[model samples]
Target: MNLELTASNVYKSYNGNQVIRDCSYSFDMCDIYILTGPNGSGKSTFLRICALLENPDRGEIEYSSEQRVLKKDLELRRRITLVLPRVGVFNASVYRNISYGLAIRGIKGGDFREKVNRMIEFVGLRNKKDQNALTLSSGETQRLGIARALIIEPGILFLDEPTTSVDQANTGIIEDIILKMKEEHKTTVVVATHDKDQAKRLGDKVLMMNDGKIIPT
Candidate 1:
């Protein structure tokens, strides 16, 4: 089912310092929204809030469909996923790591194996499917993280600095995978990045963040 995420008057603070200031936005289904800003501009924090991984100090984060709003329960949470800047990997094989998400959800069988294999190949990690995930280079690990997140087929994908540790080649490949998600899967993707060029290349709409507030781009 398609879901829309809306945030209103969001405010977040850590200690005496406020990180987010009255941020408000609506994320539509099947469109790519780029949240661009400098390193400490609260882009990643905003993404976490939108993904419901973090609660805002004062705001409303409503997940609703055209029919009605859904509760902020486990079911709603399962429909979204987030990938951080530094992707944590397991000591297990690439295949195993990619299959972990489905396994935890009690999903296994021929269908599960097929999805795992497809995702491994999708991120250009077919050759390394059997390699240990922890041994993967920075670029490959990032690809693995993307594959892991995509395997679950989250309705809304929040990618925070997906290419930060990746090289130029892998960066292009990751970008292509994201674009393909938009073109083929109709996943609602929100990416946090500091690169304006990348935002231009990938975003259906670009929103700038500064001083913990979203500015129109």
Candidate 2:
């Protein structure tokens, strides 16, 4: 089932200062999209609205599958995941951090252990599986965040400047993981970035933004 997410005439403002202005776009399932722009251009805000992390001050966001509209609810939100620029991790072990979501959803025992272990290895953190998440470097922490987000197999993934604080080596790894998710899991990806090279490398389609509006590429 191919899902589609659409936003129409979206507008957002903070402290009475307009951030996103009349933005509209549609995203289809299993494709990678890049939202590129400069600082304060509203890329993150726009992505948040689409990911259902924030509501638009004006306009509507709709989800549909096979041309039939679906309700926007907790279930729908569960299918979409967002990874912010700053990496957030639990104070516990890397194993616990990645397994938290799975455990919440009732996965346990051998099934739970397998999933957690696989994800840890996939993110190149197997050697650090028992290490405290807070002790990880920026790159390792970012990888952990990606592993956590992907463990649940979200239908749509929103990455807001995910590599902004990452080193070049880790940036390449993150980019590869993003591509791998799209190709293997068929997870629809929406990435907001300022790096033109990264956009070209990973984006199936690019949407350029400026001053809270999407500009023609």
Model number with the top TM-score: 1
lDDT of 1 by residue, 105-213 (tens): 9997999999999999888999999999999988899889989998988989999999886899989999999999888778899999998999999999999999999
Positional deviation of residue 170's Cα in model 1 after best superposition, in angstroms: 0.6
Window of ten residues with lowest summed lDDT in model 2: 1-10
The total number of steric clashes, by the backbone 3 Å criterion, in model 2 comes to 0
Question: Please, what are the lDDT tens digits per residue for candidate 2 over residues 1-217?
Answer: 4468988999999999999999888888899999999999999999889888899999999988888888988778777889888867889999999998888788889988988898898889999999999999898888899899989888788888989878999999999999988888888999999999999999999999999988646
Candidate 1 collision pairs: none
Error of 2 at 8 (Å): 0.7
What overall lDDT goes with each candidate model? 0.91, 0.89
**Segments in model 1 whose C-alpha atoms lie over 4 Å from true places:** none
Candidate 2: where is the Cα deviation over 4 Å? none
